[model samples]
Target: MIPTNRLSSSRNSRKPVCSRAVSRRGLIVAGLMLGLLGAGSAGAYGLCPGEMENAGRMQQRILREWPLRSSSDPASRFIQQLGVFLAQYGDEGIPWRFSLVRNLAPNAFSIGAGNVFVTEGAITFAQSESELAAIIAHELGHELAGHFCADSYSRGEGDIFMPPSEHYEVGVGSIRQSIDPAKEQQADRIAVSLLQAAGYDPHAMLQVARRLPAGGEVHLHDPRRIHSLERLLAGYPPAGGLPDSLTFKEVRRVIMGETHQR
Candidate 1:
């Protein structure tokens, strides 16, 4: 067990919401701890006793309790088909299953063992099939990379999973942290390559690039707060980066059109 004193000390130095604010970083530590093994046969992602099962429960409740259930439209099914297409190429097709979450939030995320869930709002916001594919492909990329098993460790961070999930708070934190800035960028590069390898349009990723926040341009990236991912997809400072002329503004216009996101 991590020393109580050390945990207290770590908590004291943090901001009021520092636990959450720095949550992503702590998640990284959990993952790095696993790397200490130095070498091994890769285990699995989201196969922990409670990991995927817990996620299923969480999602099921959301469907039951939330007033905003996803639409049962054909478009949603179509989106699922697109996801299925991209998933077959993933390293974990048998274990992974794709689902479209009927929520609005313009968010897309995945749980290990092939659980790729994309929000309805994110899909509605997408201008085309390829654009949607870009987001799904990116999340799928993380699952295929074995980020879950990579982050799981006896680091004793107590499994930072969200409350009631039998995971340490730190274990949950490390999930997002598994891919650091460098690893994140590498993942994006790999996402694009994977999408292309699967015969999707390479430039389809540009739509996601354009949809990123404007503040990101200053960093020479797609400023969506996913810094590592943005820089990788935006590609900059040479080294096979995107052509210098492709600006965020151009991409933004295509995604935003005359209407702006509030």
Candidate 2:
């Protein structure tokens, strides 16, 4: 973890990373290498605390126990870039490590402090970049909100995606439940704000809610979730923002083996 920098230059005047709009997303993706600077400055943002050594140690443990897939893959790098970009708006104290796992279940989770892991299935299932980014934003919301800082999870020290608790914080000796319903809603709300503020279409979250199947790891039920999300964005319907990327499509093609030859 290092110093942190502001995501936009000033709320009013944002400097796009590219001269051409088509490559703007690519530029943002590349700019993340230096995005983690300017620590202790986001007080108004309240992203994270100034120190996170404890959370850092836990992140190491999770990385050690679980085999992480290489992020060199374009699709994987895209996901990492999304997380890093969203993170730039959060606390700099958080290292914000992103990883792609081999699991088939469409799941995403964050643990310790700033570790966000997305499953291969999630990538394959997401129809567009916005839908995928919405999911990532939700998971990152969990980390930013300090849900993992719960006393039970802090010492439990078990794999987060397991039965009982399942996908994003299972219990150790005992079977503690998964993330609280209230917390899920809170994350959803926070995610919308984060996505919108980051120049992403907030309604993309609603699109994801419709695509997900019922049950395991799907919180708040789709219809209800959709209603709430729609209301939240009612005031701010989609306007110009980040668009679906060919990079995302190509990544999907490589992972899903679907030809874009047409």
Candidate 3:
């Protein structure tokens, strides 16, 4: 309903270049073009004129479409706390807001502007805090790396922030976008760093990747992605840095209970 893409790692780009520089350059160019050619021309770069304003509108539109769990819910609070905790190690400029979507599908996604949502099914799917953290961290990676802008430009989608049509379905497959495979791999690498910095077992990301169904347009084939993650993990020491937190266990229990009742 947010008109956003789901999380699934794919493609193997052995070289991890600094994408931030590319993003910044693209934005600057987009800005210049907007000034010269006006708002209509800016869409050529996958940017809406006044991105921050569009982001706000986009967030509002998504909230309207999706049924989010109340913020007061314990499970919702846990997601917020975990997202904020992981965010501290990354970009401090973006005001990251994490929310629990009421959907039962095991998915997570970020609609630009530091907003991340994890479905109830995804929470239940994760076996531990670190695994859940991996999902959140990966979404953060997408935001931090400016994937939304780059992805939009690549596909020539012209303002991905636009509201969805009335006929849109509130299903996982309906909302998921197939991002470039290279960008997906880049996000995976960034998630590893975020997990390590947050004292989570970096391997937790790999674990979740393995559990995901393979050969979807949104995800890389299992073997290639697994091999890439394996190579990346080889650089880190073999220490399980942290265990699942009691908070996550409780939150998962509450969410599972509510899900069953529904």
> Across residues 120-196, which tens digit of lDDT does each residue of candidate 2 receive?
77888887777788899888767655565433243434433232343344331232336565566666766776676
In candidate 1, clashing pairs total 16
Scored by lDDT, the top model is 3
With a 3 Å backbone cut-off (N, CA, C), the pairs that clash in candidate 3 are 10-220
* Order by TM-score, highest first: 3, 2, 1
Candidate 2, 150: how far from true, in Å?
A: 3.6
Clashing residue pairs in all predictions, respectively, total 16, 7, 1
lDDT of every model, 2 decimals: 0.45, 0.60, 0.65
lDDT of 3: 0.65
Q: What is candidate 3's lDDT per residue for 1-262, written digit by digit as tens?
A: 0101211112122113344425433432443434421121111112222444545655676677789999998899999999988765554445678989898877788876678888888899898889999989888777766665532432332335232342111224334454454556677877777687678999998988888865432343456667788999998788596887898988899888988999
The all-Cα superposition gives candidate 1 an RMSD in Å to the true structure of: 14.2
Please estimate how well model 1 matches the true structure, expressed as its whole-model Cα lDDT: 0.45
Candidate 3's C-alpha runs over 4 A off are 1-49, 150-176, 215-222
Residues 30-119 of candidate 1 have per-residue lDDT tens digits of: 323454111211122224334455446445544564343234544445555666666544332126556655455566666554666676
Candidate with more favorable, higher TM-score: 1 or 2: 2
